[model samples]
Target chain A: MAIHHLESVFFREKVAEALEDQTLRGALQNATGLFRQRRLAATASLSDWEKLRDQARAIKAETLTHLDHYLPEFVAKAESNGIKVHWARDHQEACQVISQLVSEKQARRIVKSKSMTTEEIGLNHVLETDGAEPIETDLGEWIIQLAGETPSHIIVPAIHKTKAQIADLFVDQLSIEPTQDAEELTKAARRILRHHFAQADMGISGVNFAIAETGSILILENEGNARMSTSLPKVHLAVMGLEKILPRLADLEVFLRLLPRSGTGQHLTSYQSILSGPKRNPDQEGPEELHLLILDNGRSAILAEEITRQSLACIRCGACLNACPVYQQIGGHAYGSVYPGPIGAIITPQLAGLSETKNLPYASSLCGACRDVCPVKIDIPEILLHLRAKSVEAHENGKEAKGFRMWAWINRSRFRFVWAHRLARLGGRIFMKNGQPPQWLQRRAPVLGAWAKHRQVPTLAKRSFREIWKKELSRKQP
Target chain B: MTRNEEAKEAILQRVGQALNGGGVRAPRKHPITDQHYAGRPQTDLDLVSSFQEKLESVGGKVIRAQNLEQAFNELWSICQERGIRNLACSDAPSFRDLTDQAPEGLEILDFPHEQAELLEAEAGLSEAQLGIAETGTLVLDGEQENHRLTSLVPPVHIAFLSSKNIVLHLGEALSRAQQARSFPRTLTFITGPSRTADIELTLVVGVHGPRELVVFLLP
Candidate 1:
């Protein structure tokens, strides 16, 4: 398997570039604000929102802990229901399985609904390379795919793009007349994609929740493309991460309530297709064959560490992305991974090794907003801190570790701490002017330069708190 | 072993090892008592009105009818209003009687339709097996009546729902399906017409699915 490294630029450089793009920043701000406000209203409509979160989290915890038991049970039940099941240990195997199925069916034209798992595995590229034309049917995904870019947000893939940008892309790619009206753009996409759906030989989708008890997979979507994709095609393939399993069909009560409200602030999406298998003997519609590919893809490794395992509880609702302050400013593309925001910061590093994605763990300000909005109640900040520690431990002798060690040594005793602070104050007085570190000082201390690049150099207070306490405050208090 | 089997064994082994590892702790049990899974608090409104309100909020329209004849009358007017010359419908026995009453000059293509004909249909009519009030969702069982395409492909989808089938929430509808003798091969819960806010967060209805979802509640 090949490691697909994120974009070449460092995380800070990406942040700088993102901040410079005023249009992208404005789009992200508007989108996140809307999603946040809607999610608040939707959650408030439910009196048992907190209890639902707890129930969802508890279900996820139980399911993940005993996933080894449930996976087989699900496979057994699904097979009994006449759905062929395939297991993939990694992205390479997952892609290979899909490619084989495509070739076996000789499926040339394929239509797909929005699936983050497929994006993570880079499935479209593989299919295209194999001489298959895979069309993304989701409106946002189609827009991004046409622009030759990746999704910027989980739920709303084109969140960072303005309507004008999409209009330009449509004019350039689809050769349609340019229009800024969202309805017109959507109508254009629907007109074009419906043709693909009519001719498509294969359909692919992602599983929202796979019930072990009933051997059914529920796919929730608002656009109804998922239904068309899975229903119209001769062969339907669903790819799911191992963690998508729930023990019983009843568990959907909690998740179905939480996911839509958290993602798009809807009571329910337009369509929830609960499919148990392919079309039955007497059925006149639906796919002739159904294939379910369960991909591990480093999730079991995440499950190894108890704290990190909580990251897998995510349902990919994108609620955390909406609530995250860092994500609001920098946006999803800045993370340079398929998954982004607070959940992405934790997940990307674990799935793709920490070394490749080391900077992602530090992306958050530890404000706990993501945890608060997480439908499954994943302790994302705690997992982020744990990943940061892992990153540091991996590079024990690196500059960051040495800097931390020096700072810790300086604060070992009262005398050393006070003396170090006074020395820093003296340096601050010389090197810092009007809260700006001089260029020479920045060049001389590369660490400080890197830190101050994105932030203002804090000025030491005119009088230290200790000095004020020792001089006048003590006597005044008495 | 073949590659597929090898991968499966490896994955199961890894999962087992991860679960047994010292770092992973046993999950705290949360038994689903009725207290934990109680239905949402009920308001004073009736289920049908609640369903109508919930559905209408999401861009779906609901009509109240005294009987199938009244529902068919409303459907004919809608078809006339939309200038629908051809309509596709499900083949459920109940719908067969409704299709027979199709106004002159209107082509009623029943289920088991050719893909091309279904694609060009101006409107479609189907039957909902259950109605969920909390979300204003209609449950369509594909096996019972071949409605997968009729309710989905057309720009206008009008579904007939018996008032007695309306439930308070999704859980009740799902539980009924679970308790059924044979679960539906495919059950679709539709809350509204297909919509998207993907382009700059602008709400666009009737994207890939029906643009107009009209449900007639038959008493």
Candidate 2:
């Protein structure tokens, strides 16, 4: 994948690098702006949008609360529909199961849709290592694959690329004449990938909503690439997060309205496929075999936490990504994860654990724009704060802990408090150069200086308010 | 235990534990409410025009015919305009009248016997089970013989939809589907032709599936 996986601490460095690129900034602004406008317009048609959000939230919460029951029901229904179900506790296990299936089928060529689950497990890399070609058929995914990169946005994966850049990529990779027109470029990709779609022995897709009652998996896509990937191949495999299941088919009415409106502002995506199983007879010309892999991959850990489990309600609409002020500036690759933006900041830490992903929670401004747009009403900012507190608790013996200790000591009594104020005034006088703090303060005073990097330090008053109060009292008595 | 069985056990156990709050509470059930759409008809116009306007807005063509004769005429003219000679069609009775009157030199590859011909054919024709007015979507199930590939693989797809099958909203369609014995292995709610805005946000039609979708609404 072209998206580099760096430790979360490099978030700042990545943000800085992304901000420095003028072309990338323009592309991000244009793409996110269009998405934001369209989403606003799409939802503007409805009067009960908030009511719908609440209903969606309640439904997800209910389904997850009884997951132990609902999951088995889904499995049974899926099995009865001539579909095979596999369970994996982690990404490694998920990859292993898929690899076993590939080997069993002797599938040399595999075509795939834009599935974050596959990306989450690094499935393409695994397939390559296992000698099976995993070809991404989605246009955005295909471009990124050719460029050796991962998706930058959930809806528009290659949003960072301009038409000229895409043309250049096609010219280099597909040996086509360089053209900047988007339609011509798409035509070139279609001509090239059409053959691969027909030749692929197996197809892999990601599920948007798995209707447990009907034993059907819904895949939402504007491009028909996903439809092709599932239809042309002899065998079809769909991988889904365990939390993607819905309790009833009727719930799709709410989600089907919310998802497209929030994602790219389409009334409905060009194609919404509700595939229950593979081709059943000579009548249907779909895949002969169908397999669905329900992957847990640390989502159960999220479900285990009472406060943060609501994060699983996310429908991956990418609405929050467009609404996020921070995401609009830095784009998704800066987060260094398959999922990015507000949902990513909250869920990635829990899914991957806090040790390496602790810095992710700090990647937000807590503006609640994400919560406003989330179809399932995941309280993203609240979850971010929760994760931040958890991260701090794990770092109790660190610099912040010492700073809090000093703060406690100063507020113990009047004398110490006065002395602390005096010391602060003196430090400000010494540190202030040209009426501003020097750049070296960041290196010298680690905590305060780090805070000063993106903000202005509040100047200490010339005289303490306590001193002025005492003098005024003495004057009144006289 | 076998790995698959052990994995399932571990997952289900984790879920039970999570719902139980690590032994703090007991498993609880949450009530699910259905009939969410208020069960009111929102559209003022007749179902066919509403469905037609909605479908055409998304780049799909809706040919309105009062009877099967006019429907066949519209289809024949469409085939002439597209210059389609070999059209793959479904074996549904709704399209039987049109198939019988298929233009001269037009070879209809009727399924399930000719299902394999859809892949190589330029155009495919099938009868939709339902037409949704709210989104201009055609609902088709996989259980129907010659339904799947006839509408998917070909560059152009022509669907025959009856006026009676038109619904006011998706909720109506869902309720109908819910009452069914069981959903087929595959179903589709196609709104427009296969399109993508993936490349620099420019709309490109016909990425993988049929580039063109034409529907004939018969009264």
Candidate 3:
């Protein structure tokens, strides 16, 4: 299992690879574009969509503020409702607990419903190392698993793989005949997974929301596989983040209105399940033991930062991923972590350590599209700047961030301020002219150089923003 | 300390230092507001009709029945057509009445009642505490053993809803739940079944939930 303490250097290389690959560009652009369109259409029915976003943000903010209270209460309530809850501070321990259960159950085969949390924890690889044959039931996740690749998109894990590629992969992995048609492709994949579904001893999944008031785990999906994974299997293990908690059962109402509209642009998801606990006594079919692994994995660090804390408000609807310009071009693979897109750019750096994954913070156009489409209304561009500061702080112990502090000191003196402006403008022109543009635009990681790649300085017109504003003001004064 | 505990402790310490407190909470400046449902009604009937209208808009069938007996007749007919016999629910009086009205050997159980046990049932019959008309949501409370698991763990869930308990928006239903003064230890607002977009952005339903949800709307 790859204990991916991924470094910034790795992300830079991957981003470079993504830039060079037009095939990946087309796939990402195509998929994100469709998602954006669908999402827009879905939200159109709601007249007060913006207001709804604000409301959702307020609710999340309120929950987080009282999270110290809510978290303990949620834990207690879930336990009361017959949920076996375990707290994992990081991915490795989370995996250990799951594997221990698998060992305890003597499980040889496992099936999974689609969960980004499991992906973040690298659960599949861990299980495989433990000699458990884990099968990804979701079609996209299944493809990525079979291909030995990480998910490139939050919602569409196999967005990089075309239908023909999937057909071929299926033929290779399973002795199934291939067809190019999507329905046929889906049927083929489903046929392969159906047997695994009936045979798997344990199931793993991710929660959409852990309702604190009810201790009900909300999972929304379109396929019957999640049903089977948690239902047919003897034991079900769910991995969730602490941030996924909402205080009341009523909160699901707001999330339901927002999630599908922001994610797939559906007014309502096809299947919504409220899993209270393990299967009841004499129940027809459901998991015997239900265990929830609440993973922290560096989120508390993110929570401590005033700026980046808003990033935690994300619902993982992938709306921001589709809305991000940088993500649309390079795809999820370039990010080199479990999370991808604009959200990943900010989140991955924090989770893996900014010193190690600092390049991720730079992977944005700062177009503010992610913030625009975010259901929970996280101000991503602002968070991006905050993370950039955190990254610099991580590197210089305060020196890398000294540039801003230096500018602040310089700004107090008109002489130093003007001098600095002249120097910066002249430098911008020189770098813009002599550096071959691509050198600056080229990021080793999608999070870096991605902006400069598609944009250029218009040969700084011998003026800065202050100077331009001053001249405009003088003209108006006349 | 275990690896996870160490991580959590590290997070707590790091964040605590940053926030300048042993533990500090992040709070938003303003209250939340919902502006999605335009021209939604304040009247209960409006809420029920609006939600009913939406369910129908999504190619779903929504019919108003006069009583529990009428609802059961319709459900039984559907079950018979589908060859379903076993049923599970979260012990609602209406559902209990329907189960009592059922023929012998029609298996039924209120779900998630016994931890770590499987109820080898085919169909499920459950009653919703409250229904949201705008988004087509069914409210479930866990303090009642029957509410949470009945719809989720079953294959086919026939959600028995009374029209009188329907609300216009999620906010209304939620506010009402809180207004009930003493809150249930666990409240579940189930909008639909368990679903996922993890697979190639394809939406799949019945993932860790009931594949078929048939709402029994009664007067």
lDDT ranking, high to low:
1, 2, 3
DockQ of 3: 0.24
Clashing pairs in 1: none
10 residues in a row with least lDDT, candidate 1 chain A: A1-10
- For DockQ, the strongest prediction is 1
Angstrom error of the Cα, residue A152, model 3: value is 1.2
**Ten residues in sequence with the least summed lDDT for candidate 2 chain A:** A1-10
Q: Considering summed lDDT, which 10 consecutive residues are worst modelled in model 1 chain B?
A: B30-39
- For A1-478, candidate 2 gives per-residue lDDT tens digits of 1122535657888888999998999999999999999999988766777877777888888888778878888889988988988889888898899999999999999999999888888899999999999999899999999999878888889999988888998998889987888988988888778788878899999999988788889999987888888887889999999999888887887888889999989888988888888776655668889899988888887888768889998899999999999999999988888888888898778888788788899999899999888988888999999999999999999888888998998899989998989998998888887556887877887776778777778889888877787878667885
Better of 1 and 2 by DockQ: 1
Over B1-219, each residue of candidate 3 has an lDDT whose tens digit, in order, gives 865556556544554454455354545332533333332334545766787777655544566788866777777777777877776666655555445677665655543455322334666666777887877777765444445455655556667788888877766776776676555434555555445544344545554456456777887
Candidate 3, residues A329-373, lDDT tens digits: the string is: 788888878788888877887777666677887888799998888
Tell me how far the alpha carbon of residue A161 in candidate 1 is from the true structure, in angstroms, after superposition. Answer: 0.9
Could you give candidate 2's per-residue lDDT for residues B1-219 as a string of tens digits?
Answer: 878888888988888787777555434444444456422346685788888988999899888789877887887888888788878777777656455678887777766644346567888888888889888999986666457677877889988888899998877787787677767667788898989898889888987888899998887
Supply the TM-score for candidate 2: 0.95
